[model samples]
Target chain A: MIRICIFMMILLATYSCNDVLDVPSQSDEDIVLELWNHIDRNYCFFELKGINWDSIKTASLARLNVSTSESDLFEICGDMVLALEDGHAFLRNGQTNIVYDFKEGYDVHFDPIIVEKKYLNSSFQREGIYTYGMINDSIGYVYLYGFQNRELFENIKGYFKQRNPQKLIIDVRNNGGGDSALSLEIVEYLIDEETKVGYISVKNGEERDDFTEVANVVATLSSNNYPVKTNILINRGSYSASSYLAGMVKYIDNINVIGQITGGGGGGGQSFELPNGWVVRIPHHYFLDAKMNHIELGVEPDVEIENTELDIMNQRDLMLEMAIEY
Target chain B: MIKFDLDTYRLRFSLTPIKHGVTGLMLMISASVFSQSNKTMFFKAGFVQQSTFENRLTSNYRGGVGLNLELGFEKTSEKYVSRFSLDYSKANQGKSYISYSTIYKVDLKYENLKRIHTIKGLYIGGYIDVGTMINEKNGLWGSTNNPISFTQWASLGMVAQYSVKFKNDYLWNMSLSTPIVSYIIRPSYGSVWPDKFLEPQNFNLYERGIVTAGLKSGNVALFNNFSNTIIKTSMYFPFKNSQWHYGLEYSFNRIHTNEIKPLKQFANTISISFKRL
Candidate 1:
């Protein structure tokens, strides 16, 4: 027994993990090929968007050589990521992020200078990324630039107690988006029961059409309720979780979404490491709005209020003005 | 908040001696602590090492090593023996020891063996073990609500054991176990925000649901697979009325999955246990 015990102890004491695996190659071909292959199998959209990923991959490889510079390769990879037309598509390169933008033709209407000087002046109180104040005395206004707000609902509650406004305006014009859960927390407060918001699913297999079973997206009852009618203002820059918020709350009666068509980024994305160490973020989960309409590109406003260049030049945000007027 | 920086995301201790000395000190302390103590609680400290290839995250395999701690017990009788264990481990994985990514895991297990026959000092029996392994990686962030990469599994496996006795006073036990069938839960492909986060109340065909897996998973074009095997042996030394138990355990897990990544992991640990009369 003593001999067996000693042997096992000796074995355990001597055991050590060796660094055995060969280092991965960082050649240009290897980098591009890895990105192409990984995206080919893992990227969720192709069939949905009718994109020829193979053709893009072929073209991208042709542009590269064994001696392609890091900057040129980055641009090439960036171009490939943009081919999906997904605004959520982002290639993280160090501190400078290579992100996709679909808001080129669509103009940004929210004039921060005008809103600050004209509407908020010195009355706005800030919480997280949301900036808020009363615009028409009886009407409350909240400008949400991002959903990184943890105290969003709390900020609004304070505003309610202080102003006692009958209606609230939620301006999400250039709000790029953040945690969707934060958006849901506020939306759930406006509804009564557990509501079916939409259907959500994602790509499941290597095939472009391969998808997981669809799940009915439901919003449960909120523990606390917000007082007053709500109006959400959006524009071409409203995307991802912002669009998701609009799509979700469109089912509520008391809440109104008023603005131009939003920048549609209606799926969830995940990140992967490129052979060159750049991080690529892509979305696979796509959502179907309450009426089963695809909101992947953007969400249509319940009431379209186009904020023209003329409006901005005249120091007026028509979208915000419309919400305040309503 | 989780930050996925391209360069590195590692939490290193400020004190070098503490960080470097922890492994050896923990091994010695845990060995002595457990030995002085069957139907008994025990503690174990060891190294957990892994080589992982999750095509969803990267094309190349990543290697890592870190500390592992386990708390478990063994109860034995002439006709039967029962064992239970729970363990936690954390590791940072990347090439050349670069702490680019982190993985956290928790494991739970239970086993019961009934002796069918005994020849010489060798007793043979089949044991039943039901357990689960939950592993989460938080090294890189890809997208908001990427509900897809979550991986956890509840499995049932078959066990085989060998018992040895010397001079009718000392006891030695060895066992091998494999997870043959499992009801695995993972986020459906491409979904952001794992089901565990989004639909905690619902576990259906879609969202957070059970996907059946057998000996092997996945197919030709691109795939990651899992095969879980565990080997354990323990020796008991009696002192007066109380008993001391020394043990060695090694697990070879070929993390077969269709979730996000496929990992090859090996855990080596030694433990001492104390039991009452």
Candidate 2:
């Protein structure tokens, strides 16, 4: 009986049934493939390009093999994307919003005219590239680039009051843009009090005095009447805020703008971040002159002063020379 | 003293020698005879080394314990033959390895030759077996706390064996048998990944549900499935007595499925047993 029991137990142990299920692991090749799949599925404009996905696969493998770390792989991906040749499709880290100019010269092109005045507590630095003759023997030739800086404008005004210059040359060349609020204030000292500056029509898709900001400047200028002769110079780079200065002066009977057609562009743009962690800057609002036209194409200069290679070789600035002659 | 009952005379005596000596002697004599019986009870234990190459850069090795139990019963009247067997093994290497398996076999056989209740001769028989496979591994991702584990679909197979019994006596018995053919369902083996993220092409098929589905569909294609099974023709040689028996078997197995490269090998197994007949 005991023997039979042992045998039965062994038989039972041997005959029992069991079942097991399992899941599998993924390989490195699969990871690379998945990355590409995600890009193809989500990237904008994927269908438009004649991209060889198979070659991309081989290239990605070769790239990954050489990557020493995760960041290296990311950089390789960036390089591959850049190879796609779409200027707008570039990749960059989503950090700092600041854009830098690595070129040798200053972003704005101009020289400074420093003058001392008694009414003003500080000295004045008037920036411009055109030269107008000296007012007093002490106050030398002067060229005004921008009127935006309040302290700088006040001191310069004090100097003008003291010296009473014969002519003022304002150069807007290389003046990309800045605040237009100070233009009217500077114009008050330069023009007759009642003179009307040209009107501005800010085509910002709204209806209100289009040039409300410039009107504010004109209002201040109309209140303060100081008579002075001024000359403004314009160029290809004279745009936006700088054009506003040139336009305000040229509207008056005495002030004159001398140069070629401005690149009429007065649109306000906004920067935004894209889904792929890239930053894009696009024009959000448009600007117009008193004539209700876009400033983006630029405010055309009243007097066309075309500079040529011979002019540069002769070390002659025809625009400034013309302004002086006018 | 003797008591007479009917036409028979009965003699009763206290023959319990040494208080238990005669029973012990009888037991000793019977044990020897039983050890040589045609019907045998078998016990075997060994280590099985299983190697699988994925055809990738790496190959896996698993070493585990294997045990077998075989019971062969043959009665003279009709050469009534039957075999019951149990086999278990488990092996692993590194982070991956095969899981434990428990196999049970029960075979009922009929012999061609017949004799009185005490004797039997040649017989041909077939058997059916049901088996199960379990796989255990660590979870792809998550706390090491939650290890991954699962079981495979139950497997079933049929096998045929041919045997011949020579002599039956107080001293010993002798026999020989061979297993002809077998048909079986094999379990698929694989690993677990954190996500579908990095799996090889068709790797997901090794997963539990897919593997089961594939088996149901008669076998998955090479790209999608992997498994293990031994199909072979074998020869068995046995020497037995009334109380004990010894046997040896040699088989040429061809592994045509469940591998990157099909393999063929000749393997042998030896068994020892004791029985009562």
* A260: Cα error in model 1, Å: 3.2
lDDT digits (tens) for residues A5-120 of candidate 2: 33433332232211111112233344445445433332322223455555776887786663346455546555545443332233333432222121113122222222123111
**Candidate closest to the true structure, highest lDDT:** 1
Alpha carbon lDDT of each predicted model: 0.63, 0.37
Docking class of 2: incorrect
> Distance from true position, residue A282, model 2, in Å?
3.4
| DockQ, Cα level, model 2 | 0.01
- True lDDT of residue A23, candidate 1: 49
lDDT of model number 1: 0.63
Worst 10 residues of 2 chain A by lDDT: A16-25
Task: Supply DockQ values for each candidate.
Answer: 0.18, 0.01
